[model samples]
Target chain A: MIVWTLLEWLAWGASGLILAWMVADALRVSHDYDEDVLLSSREGEMIMDEPHDAA
Target chain B: MAQAQAVTETKAQPIGLLRVLGPGHVWALGVGIVLVGEYMGWNFSVGKGGALGSLIACWVIGLLYTCVAMIDSEVTSTVAAAGGQYAQAKHIIGPLMAFNVGLYLVMAYTMLEAADALIVGDLVVALAAGTGVEGVDPKPFVILAISLLALLNYRGVLMTLSVNFVITAIAFLAIVVFFLSVEPWNPGAVLHHADLLAGLPYGWLGVVAAFQFGIWYYLGIEGTCQAAEEVRSPARSLPYGTMSGIITLLIAASLTWYVAAGLLPWEYLGQAITPLYDAAQASGSTGLQVFLFIGTLFAASASANGCINDAARAWFSMGRDRYMPIWFGAVHPRYRTPFRSILFLIPIAVSFAFTGLLDQVVTFSILSGLLGYTFMPINMHLFRKRWPLGSIERGYVHPFHPLPAIVLLVLCTATFFATYLGYGVQLLAMMSFYIVASLWFAFHRYKYVRRGDQFTMPWPRPRGY
Candidate 1:
C-alpha cells in the first residue's frame, strides 16, 4: 500500500484550498464584471468597448 | 468649462496601444503560456522522482510560484509598463541590469515560441499517423501555423488575446475530460507497480533531480505581467489575474498528476510526449484520445501565441528605451502595434524552429527564467523599503513583509544550481548569450543610450510619481 508522508499530505491540502479560493474569486469577479458592463452600457463610453478590425 | 476642456483634450491625444485588456486577458495570457505544462513535459518528473516524490517536488515549485506571482503583482501594479520585469529593473537596478534582464526574457520567450511551434508540427503528424496515414512532412504545416499566429498577433491585441482565451478554456476542458475518463484506481497498485514507481529506486537524490520538471507545472505564470501596459487598470487587474492563474494551475497540476499516474504505468507515460493522449488511448476511448490529440495542438499554439505577443512587447519596450536599436520600437501607424518588434521575433523563431534543437532550446529558456527571477526578491525588498505601505498606489503587497520574497529567492537559487548541474556544459549557450549582451552594452550600447532621455542609471531616489 502507498503510505502518504506528512509533506505530501500538506501539499495536497494546499492545492485543494488554493483551488477553492481561486474558484470563489473567479465567480465573484465574473459577477462584478457583468455588473460593470451593464453599468457602463447605461452610462455610455466604456473605453475601447468595441472590437477592432485592423492593426 | 475647465473640466469639459480636460475631457476633450484627453480624448484628442492619439490612441496608443488600443488599451483593451482587462483582468480576463491577463489571466488568459498567464494561464495560456503555462497550460502546456499540465499537458506534457511535466511527466518527465516521474522518471526522476517516482509518482509520490514528484508530487512533493511539485508542491515546492508551486509554493515558489505562489510567492513569485504575488510579488510580481506588486511590481506590475506599481510600474504598469509593457516592459514588465525589464521596466521594473530599470527603475530599481539601473539600465545595464535592465538591458540584460530584457534580453534574457526576450530570448526565453522566443525559444519557447519556437519549441511550441515544433511540438505542434510533431502532434499534427502524430494525429495523422493515428489514422494509419504515414510519412506526412510537418515542416510546412509548422511554418504555416507560425506565420498565421504572427499575422493575427500583428493585426491587434484583441485577436491574440481572444484566441488565447478560447483555446485555453478548451485545453482546461480536455484535462477535465481526461481526468474523468481515467481507469478506476487502486492506491495500493501504484506502489506495487515497479515501472510506475521507477524513481523510488534512487531515494531522495531522485527527488532533487525532479526539480526541473516540477517547475514545469507553473513555469510561465508570470507572463501576464507583460500585459500590464495594456490593462485598463494594472493596480487591480494584474494581481487578480495573476493570482487566479497561479492558483488554478496548482489545482490542474495536482489533479493531472493523480489521474494520469493512477490510470497507467508512469514509465510508459513518462516517455510519451503527449501523455494525456497516451493515457486516453490506454483508457480504451480512441475518440477521446483523438480529441486530446487536437487539444494538445491548441495548447501548444496558445502558448506560442502568448509567447510571441509578450516577446514582441519586451523587444518593443527595450527599443523604446534605447537599450537596443530605436527602430525596433516603431509602431504600425494603422495597427498601433509594435510591428517592427513582431517582425524581428518571427525570423528568429522560424530560424530556430528549423534547427530541431528544441530540447537544448528549452534548457536555455529555463536558465533565462531562473536568472530573471533572481532580481524579483531584491526588487521587492527595495520597492517596499522605498515606498512602504500606503505611500504609493500599490495592489496586493505580499503579506509578512519580505518573507515571501526571501523564500522565493532561495527556491529560485536552488533551482538555478540544480539546473546548472543537470545541464552542465550545454548551458554554455546561455553563458555565451550573456557575454554577448555584456560586450554589446560595454562597447556600443552605453554611449548611445547615455545621451538619450531613456537612460535611468545612477539609481535615483523614489519621487513617488
Candidate 2:
C-alpha cells in the first residue's frame, strides 16, 4: 500500500518537474530573443534549384 | 527593404529547428504513433463481420494504405515542411484546403493522444484492481502521461523520437514473440483455428463494414512526413522511412490477427477491449501476460508521444503562415521547438483526456483521418496537373501517375460508406463540424494569411499560375 502511494506521488512530482523545466526554458528563450527573428525562419525554399528529371 | 530582410534572415538562423533526424527516427515516429492499435481496437472488425471478414478487410484496407504511402511519398518529397499534408495542400491546392487539412491533422492526432492516455489510465486502474489494489484514480495518471510527453516534445525532437523508437520496437517485438510462442506449424499446438473460424456472418457487406475498423492496423503510418523539416534528407528518408514502417505494420498486423483469432472465439474477440492481452491470458502463462501488459503500456505511451509531436507541428505550421495567430509561429531560441504551439495544445489535449469518452474520442479521430485521406487524391491530381514532371524538381515521384491517385480516390470513397454503416451519426456530425470550421477559416482566418509567403518550396511558379 505504501509502495503504490509513493509511486503515485513520484509520478506526479516527475510530471511537474518536467513541465516546470519546459515552461522555464520557454520563458528564458523568449526573454533573450526577439519574436520577429524567431518567426522569420520559413525553410524549404532553394532546397533543390535544378529540376533534374529522375526518369 | 533588402537590408531589413537580410537582418531578419541572419537572426532567424539561431532559432531554426535542427535537421538532425534520419530514416530511423522517421520510421519510429510513423510506427510509434500507430503500434498501439495492433494491441487493441482492431478486433472490432470481427464484431461487424466475422473472423474471415476481418481478415479480408485487413488485406483490402492494406491496399488502400499502400496507395496512401505511394501518393504521400511522392508529394511529401517535394513539399518538405513540418505540417505534412497541410503543407502539401497549401502549395498545391489553396489556403482553404490547407486550413481544412491542418485541422484534420491536429484533431486526428490530439484526439488519438487523448484516447491513448485514456487507455493507459484505464489499463493501470484495471491492472491494479486485478492485483488487489482498488480505489485508484485514473485521472492523475492520464495527466501525468500527457504532461511528461509534452515536456519531452518541448525539450527536443531528436531525444523525443529516439525514445519513441526504442519503446515502439519493444512493443512491436512483443507481437512477434507471441506469434513464435504459438508455434503455428505444430499440429498439437493450442491454436484452435479450425474450430474458432466463423465464415462471414454478415456476408460481403460485413466485410465492407469491417473496413472501418481494419484501418486501426495501419493508421498514422504516413505521419513520418510531419517531421519533414527536421529530416536530414527529406527526399530519401521520408519515402524510405514511411515505406519501411508500412511493411513492418503489415507483418505485425497479420501476426496479431493470426495469434488472437486462433485463441479466442470471434464473437468475444471482436468485443474484447484488450484482445492481445486476453489471448495471452487464455494461454495461461503469467510471463506472456506480463509481457503483453507492458507492451500495451509502452505502445500507448509511444503513441501519445508521437501524437504530441505531429499535432504541434501541424498547428505550428498553420500559425507560421498566419492561418491562426502569428504569436503561435514563434520558435524557441534555445530548443528550437515550436514552444508556443506546443504549450497551446497541451491544455486542449488535457481537456480531451479529461472528457474520458473513449468511444466518441476515437470515432472523431478515425473520421478526421478519413477526411485527410480524402484530400490526398485531389492534392496529387492538382500537383501533377500544375507542375508536370521536370517542370519542377521532385525528390521522389510515384510512378503510374494517375493510377495511384485514381485508386486512392476510389478507396477513400468506399471507406466513407463503410464508416457510415456503423458510425453514421458520428460521420455526419464530424462533416458538419468541419463545414463550420471551414466557414470560420474562410471568413475570419483567411485575411490574416500572408499570400506571398505561401510558396515556400523551391519550385517554378506552377505551370498554370
Best candidate (score: lDDT): 2
lDDT of 1: 0.74
Question: Local distance difference test, per candidate?
Answer: 0.74, 0.87
Evaluate residue B164 in candidate 2 and report its C-alpha lDDT on the 0 to 100 scale. 96
Tell me how far the alpha carbon of residue B428 in candidate 2 is from the true structure, in angstroms, after superposition.
Answer: 1.6
* Residue B291 error, candidate 1, Å: 2.6
- Candidate 1 structure quality by residue, lDDT tens digits, B1-465: 765554344333333465678888998899999888888888887877777767877898898899889889987777777778888887776777788889878988888888888898787677667667666666655666677777767767877998999998898888877766553354443223334544464587777777777887887788898886778787899999999999889988987787777666856766667777777776777778767877788889999999999999889888776678776665443354666687678879888888878677777777787778888888888787776776676767777868998898888877766676678675676778798888889788877774445533233456464
lDDT of 2 by residue, A15-49 (tens): 77877877777776666567776786575532222
Question: What TM-score results for chain B in every one of the models?
Answer: 0.91, 0.96
Q: Give the residue spans of candidate 2 off by over 4 A.
A: A45-55, B1-14
Candidate 1: residue B73 lDDT (0-100):
90
For each candidate, what TM-score against the reference? 0.83, 0.94
Error at B208, model 1, angstroms: 1.2
lDDT by residue (tens digit), candidate 1, A3-33: 2233234434553554354345334433432
- Best model per TM-score: 2
